[model samples]
Target chain A: MTAVRCVDLCKTYRQGEVDIKALDHVSIEIKEGGFVCLSAPSGGGKTTLLNAIGGLDKPDSGEVYIAGQRIDNLSKGELAELRLRQIGFVFQAFNLIPVLTARENVEFVMQVQGVPAGERQRLAHAILDEVGLAGLEDRRPADMSGGQQQRVAVARAIVSRPALVLADEPTANLDSKTADELMELFRELNDHHSTTFVIATHDKRVMGYAKRLVRMLDGRIVADIKQDAA
Target chain B: MNLVFRLAWRNLWRHPRRTWLTTAAMMFSNTLLVFMISLQFGMYGLMIDNTLQAFTGHLQIQAPGYKDDQKIRQTVADIVPLAESLRAELPSVSIAARGTAFALVSSEERSYGIAVFGVEPAYEPDVSTIPGLVSEGRFLGDIDAPEIIIGAALARNLRAGLGDELTVLGSGRDGSFAAAVVDIVGIFDSGIADVDRSITEIPLGLFQDVFFMDGSGHQIVINAGSIDGVAELQSKVGSLLPAGQDLVVHDWDALQPGLKQAIKADMSSAFLMYGILVILVAFSVLNTQLMSVLERTHEFGIVMSLGLTPGRLGRLVLLETAIMGALGLVLGAVLGGLVTSWFSVNGFAYPGMEELASKFNLPARFFPQVSPLTLLVGPAVVFLFTLLAAVYPALRLHRLQPVEAMRAV
Candidate 1:
């Protein structure tokens, strides 16, 4: 089964008198448990594609399906519920909620998911530990470094154990060492939990970890390739 | 719900200074409102009590038509015994029988027309403040003494002084010629210009002699403990009046019919001012909440992406406002309550207050009446307005799109 499928997705943006094609008749499919990398240069539609897949953005004309269930026509509330239940997203920067501590950030998704408090806390702590942030559970995002905040965001995204994780430049602000560690963690979650990963990034290092790599230029895919585990 | 409160409370502290400034605005307004309302009520109470004490005496038992027409013949029958019986039946009440007649007073130098009150000297002190207002000589030396107490203004008008023989001429209860020779035994400064300019008092017996009455008086005044108890006591005392004796019972409001309307007008003006103050504070809160939400737009977008619906987010902000309002209310109430309680016991008065108070026959020190109503009304109004103010900001959240909000920069 396809974890995500977008058929003829098209989105447009207007700047001054110019119409910018952010997505143009895009069509793609990623098999269940597939680790895919969507690579594009600045403003080439990687983030836009990730947003569409996560139900954060609606294309001007497109059909989006997650786990083979149509979701492009969902209401804002319905889309939010779908994202809350089945999808987890990690943005490039400004990920963690500044007001929440690391453990609370991780617990937030599960908490909103209506998981029991005890179980939520247990899962949050385990995920924080898995993200190498066990003792820093109470550090707010502002107090944490960029790398630590990214780790917390990653922990938050995976805490509820969603079926799919859509990440947009997740390692953009991290140090090379932290970036590699985060990619390794992503790979571990993908292999062990069969959690499908679709990461949109410009970083070649992050792209190196993908089982399938798709490259886009001017909102059109120019390359589609597959590779062994990093 | 607990999670929402936690998130809301945490969000409040994100901008501690802004939150405190808004909360302080609310608190200060609440405090000022409570104090102002209490003072207004206290002043109203004093005004009513002083007005009633002057001559109205909370309640009066009178003949049916005497109030409308001051006919000396329109008298409550057997007034002395009737007043005595009322005083005995209601121990807490102070009842005095008095007769009033329009008479001509001649003091050799000048003759002036004045309203003369005939009273029982002993019971008059309990039922009226006139007995305590004498600034010269004394109040009706003895009830049966052929003496009179004239107001200073009246004395000034009549050119009469203490120890001077005054002649009073008036028609009697039966329209017969009634006349008396009385010594001015006292001069009272009632402070009220209207009261002082035309009022004089004499013993009830002498009044009867001068008015040609047979143990009957114009009215029996009763001061029943406090103003708050007047209506209940009026009913009880009214029930005790001799059945079918053709007497009317009236409370102070009936005696001075315009007092309630005057108070209502004044209170409406006061609340209008109070309403403005509350709305200003509410706007201050609203501005703070909007700024806070605007600053946290990205954070909200993240939360929304994490599965929190816009409605839940809106509710979160409202909960935040509610928590902030509740906190300010409690703190402000406590602070206002403490100040009001202290002033209520020790009294609050400004310079020249004594002179001002005396002008209206009011107490020198005015005590604030801080009832539950006073305490709750101000803070409750503040709370309600704060929530109302937050509605605009909370509704703004529902319009935020996670995709767009996350890109707010």
Candidate 2:
């Protein structure tokens, strides 16, 4: 089953007198448990497509169905609920709230979902351990290294057992070794938990971890590449 | 709902600078509001007590038609039957009966026209402190005592001291002429120059002789059992007056209507000023909250996109405001309360108003007393105003879209 499907998705930005098309007639689908890398260079609409899939941006003219619900038809609150319950985002900047600890950041999503305190703590600890940061649960994002922070971000994204996770350059700020290690965690979560992973990145290391690659340029997907069989 | 509240609590600390700025502004306004109001209440109480105690002896009784027209020839003599009825019915500490007459008091070299207050010396002390305020010699000895306590300035004008004889001449109640010889037994300085310059206290018998045996007082001053008992005593005393007699009883307030009117007017004006100021402060509070939300537009989107409801987002903003307001209110009230308590105990003085103070016959030291209303009313008023201020900002949050918010960055 497809965890996310977008047909002819488009987004436009109007600056003063000029209209900029960030995404134009983009169409794609990532099935459940699939590790798909949306690879593109700068200004190739990789981030825009990821934003559209994550429910953080609405398509101007097409349909986006996340877990069978047409996101374009949902209200703001409904979209928020969809994102909270089913979709998780790992931003390029690792945008963990500066004041919250690693465990707390992961627990925040569950907290908004109205999970009990004890259950939230338990789930947050379990996810932190899964991401190989068991004893670093109380450390803040600032206190962690760039790689550790991204790992915490990855932990937070998968903590809620979201149906699909969209990571926009999750390893962009880390070195090669750390980036490969982070990709291994993503592959492990995808293989073990069967959670769908959609990564938007320019890094070749990240692209190597994908079972399929969708390449984009100038606001359009130009190539769709599949590696070995699943 | 509880989940939203949990998030809202954490949201307040997201930007410590903005939160503290808003709280500080709120505290500033609250302090100003509380202190100004407390001072106004204290000043009002002081003015009321001073004006009454200075002249009006809680309650005063006037003869029928005498207050309306002094020339009506209906002196206290007209109410002889009513006077006996009053004494029988009212539980007065003492009823100091007096006849007032426009008279000329003459010395060997100079003469001055004055208002004479005739009194029973034995009853005078119970109603007024005029006898106690004597500066020289002595006051009236008995009902038949021919001695008089001359006004201090009047004594100076006549160059008369103790044991000097003065002739008093005035018209009788029957339109006949009357004359009497009186000795200046003492001099009284009533502090208020107007009263001290013109009022002369004479014995009731001497006053009756001067007014040609009127055999009654034009006014009966009644002293109640105590200040606290004045209201009850006034009610009981009202039942004593004869039904047919035209009498008007003036309480302390009625006796000094000018002072009461001034205080009422000042209090209303002060209240209006403070009320407007509080509303303005509330607007500043609103501004602070709105600014905070604007600054965190992207963060709000993050929280909302994380599955936080619009209601929850709005509630978080309101809760943030409430926490800020509650904190400011507590601090402002504590500071305001401490100042009020200090003023209550030590009494704040406006030392520069000595002349004005003296004119009003107030003491040199002015002590502003703080009431309980000052302490409690300020916090309640601030809390209500603050909560009301948060509504618009909280509502504004509901109107914000999560997509637009997330795109804010």
In lDDT terms, which candidate is top? 1
Give the per-residue lDDT of model 1 (tens digit) for B295-332. Answer: 88988898888888988888888999999999899988
**Candidate 1 chain B superposition, TM-score:** 0.94
- The 0-to-1 C-alpha lDDT of every candidate, in the order given, reads 0.88, 0.78
Calculate the i-RMS of every candidate, to one decimal place: 1.2, 2.7
Candidate 1 positional error at A170, Å: 0.9
What are the TM-scores, per candidate, against the unseen true structure? 0.92, 0.78
Query: What is the per-residue lDDT of model 2 for residues B11-50, given as tens digits with 9 covering 90 to 100?
Result: 6777788777767776776776677778777666566655
Off by over 4 Å in 1: A67-69, A222-227, B65-74, B212-214
- Candidate 1 deviates by what RMSD? 2.7
Worst 10 residues of 1 chain B by lDDT: B1-10
By TM-score, who's the top model here?
Answer: 1
Residue B117 deviation, candidate 1, in Å? 1.9
Model 2 agreement with the true structure over A52-111: per-residue lDDT tens digits:
887777778899988777897787778778888898888777877766789888988887
